[model samples]
Target: MKLKKLMTILLTTVITTAVLTGCGQQENAKDAQKKPLKVATNATFVPFEFKGDGDSDYKGYEVDMIRAVGRVMGRDIEFNNIPFSGIIPIIQSGDMDVAASGMTITKERAGKVLFAAPFYESKLVILTNKNSGIKSVEDLKNHSVAVQMGTTAADYAQNLGLKTKQFDHNAEALMELKIGGSDAVIADKPVADYYVATEGKGEDVVIPIPDSKKEYLAFAMNAKNKDLQKEINAAIAKLKETGEFQQIYKKWFNVDPGDLPKTAEETLQ
Candidate 1:
């Protein structure tokens, strides 16, 4: 009778243990499936990422492209709005999984983060009020130029020994130009063009510098996330081949993406 009782107790204990283990495994699987891909972006740049008027949601070319990438990787994407200067550090700290805010790939940036394939080619342009008479890079000499802080445009302006007014956003820099606080605003060509069109700055001019080098924009992540980088690279290649990339480009820029390099490394060559 004692043996029968002992057997029954052992059976019940074994069944309970097995059920608990199964439940734990199922919960772990669900947690893995629910993990989101956190993407960090600065939403001040239009055509790249920005908040629309009267809208709480962020939208732009980069936002759309990253969403497509998330779909390709079978992950839910969550965007976190962060300052441009802090985006890299946040990714390095593992607080964010990706940074895709029209970030231009540079040697300094490459050392800190792993960049995916190039998604867009851009150039700096000088934007000035029509009557400002700033027609070229040389004209910026002795003029108070406005640029977004931590951007290549600001670096270029400082390198040229020009007096510069730094703003957190490109829109503020352009507004400084309009208000006569700055003689000119130097920024990405697409951003300048977008501002001019939307702000009713019909008199503004976009002056492309002849010697300015092209900047290749790409998504960046922590160096340790090589697997994620590879997946993103594959997604970008697939998007390009499937015509989805060109469609997004046309939707944002109103023109075909003509002969742009397939990867950031390709631009180096």
Candidate 2:
């Protein structure tokens, strides 16, 4: 009777161990499947996803690129539109998976987040009123230049020895410029061009900066997310090769896409 009882207890212990191990494995699998990536961005910037012309839907360049990336990766990209300054902090705190707000892959930003290769390039332009007589950066030396806060354009404007009036968004700064509250505005070329072409107030603006101040934009992910960055790089390579990237560029900028390096193209190879 003692031997039989001992045997039954041993058998039960073995079964319990196996059951616990199996449950752990199943739970791990489920966790892996549920890890959908969240991409953070500042959607207020136009031609790169913003609240549409009074509509609720998002529109513009980054919107199309994010959706294309989702399709290529077989995953959904959830865009969290936060303040520009909040993007890096949120990513650092593990609140977001990636950021793609036409972000310039600068050395400072690169140190904070893993940046993918350059996917888009935009010129840095200065905008001044038609009657301001500010035709160049030099013209704004002592004048107050309005720029979007916490942006590279703002940094550049400061570096040029201009007095800066920083606003949270480019639209606000541009508005100030139009109302004669600022001497000039510094921003990306596409945005300046868009405003000049569409907004009545922007009609008086002139692009004072040349093409040499162009900036390259890339996607950013947490430093720990090497795998996600690799996947994104692969997707960029695929899009570049299949000509889809060029099409999107044309759609947004009305220009053919620039050339990518052989290494960037061969990343997935």
Candidate 3:
């Protein structure tokens, strides 16, 4: 009887260990199935993407929006800070899955990548120190202008025949404006406002250039990723219906998003 009791205890311990090991393996298998969705961004645009103090992680409106979108799709998110100019090429090469760095939707870009629904509306603005005489796009004709490279503002400035200096980051361009390296900084309105507010340069001026063309911001993915684009579109619509998108906008801009497009195609029209 003593021998039989000892044998039974040993058998119980072996079975328990096997069951626990099997359960752990199943959990790890589940974790392994979750593929990460890689996103590329430029972290210099405040209120859109920027790094926090002492940390390399990016934090901003676009970061939060993409994470939320990932949760809805049941995918893990990985964000990479790539140069804004190279974001599309990175997506095209499959090194990254998506680009969400406050990219404007243009016919040219749309031809290269599939754009998700427009998340925000933006326009070009000129930021100058109070003493700078630059007030409009017309005023920039003879002055040295600074713009972030690979951005619509840069293109706009160049097309205007102005002598332009392109910088890697909008902050650097704004700094050039502050130090008189450039007569004016042409950038997205939101970024210009963010710089002015944070730098305590309230005395600086912002001049909005009226264009019949309205620019909308959206996420970009490779042209071949149609299924992923559909998923993203549905996710955006759900977020809008649930008011989650509005909450995100309000958190970042402190104002309502107003009327947003119901679908990605609507933004183009």
The sequence of per-residue lDDT tens digits that candidate 2 reaches over residues 5-93 is 99999999999999999999999976864566688887777767677667866678877887777678777777787878788888888
In order, the Cα lDDT scores of the candidates are 0.87, 0.77, 0.85
lDDT of 2: 0.77
The alpha-carbon root-mean-square deviation between model 3 and the true structure, to one decimal in Å, is 7.3
Model 1, CA-based lDDT: 0.87
Tell me the lDDT of candidate 3.
Answer: 0.85
Model 2 TM-score, all chains together: 0.84
lDDT of 3 at 230: 90
TM-score of each: 0.87, 0.84, 0.85
Best lDDT goes to which candidate? 1
Name the better of 1 and 3 by TM-score. 1
In candidate 3 the C-alpha lDDT for residue 239 amounts to: 85
What's the lDDT for residue 117 in model 1? 89
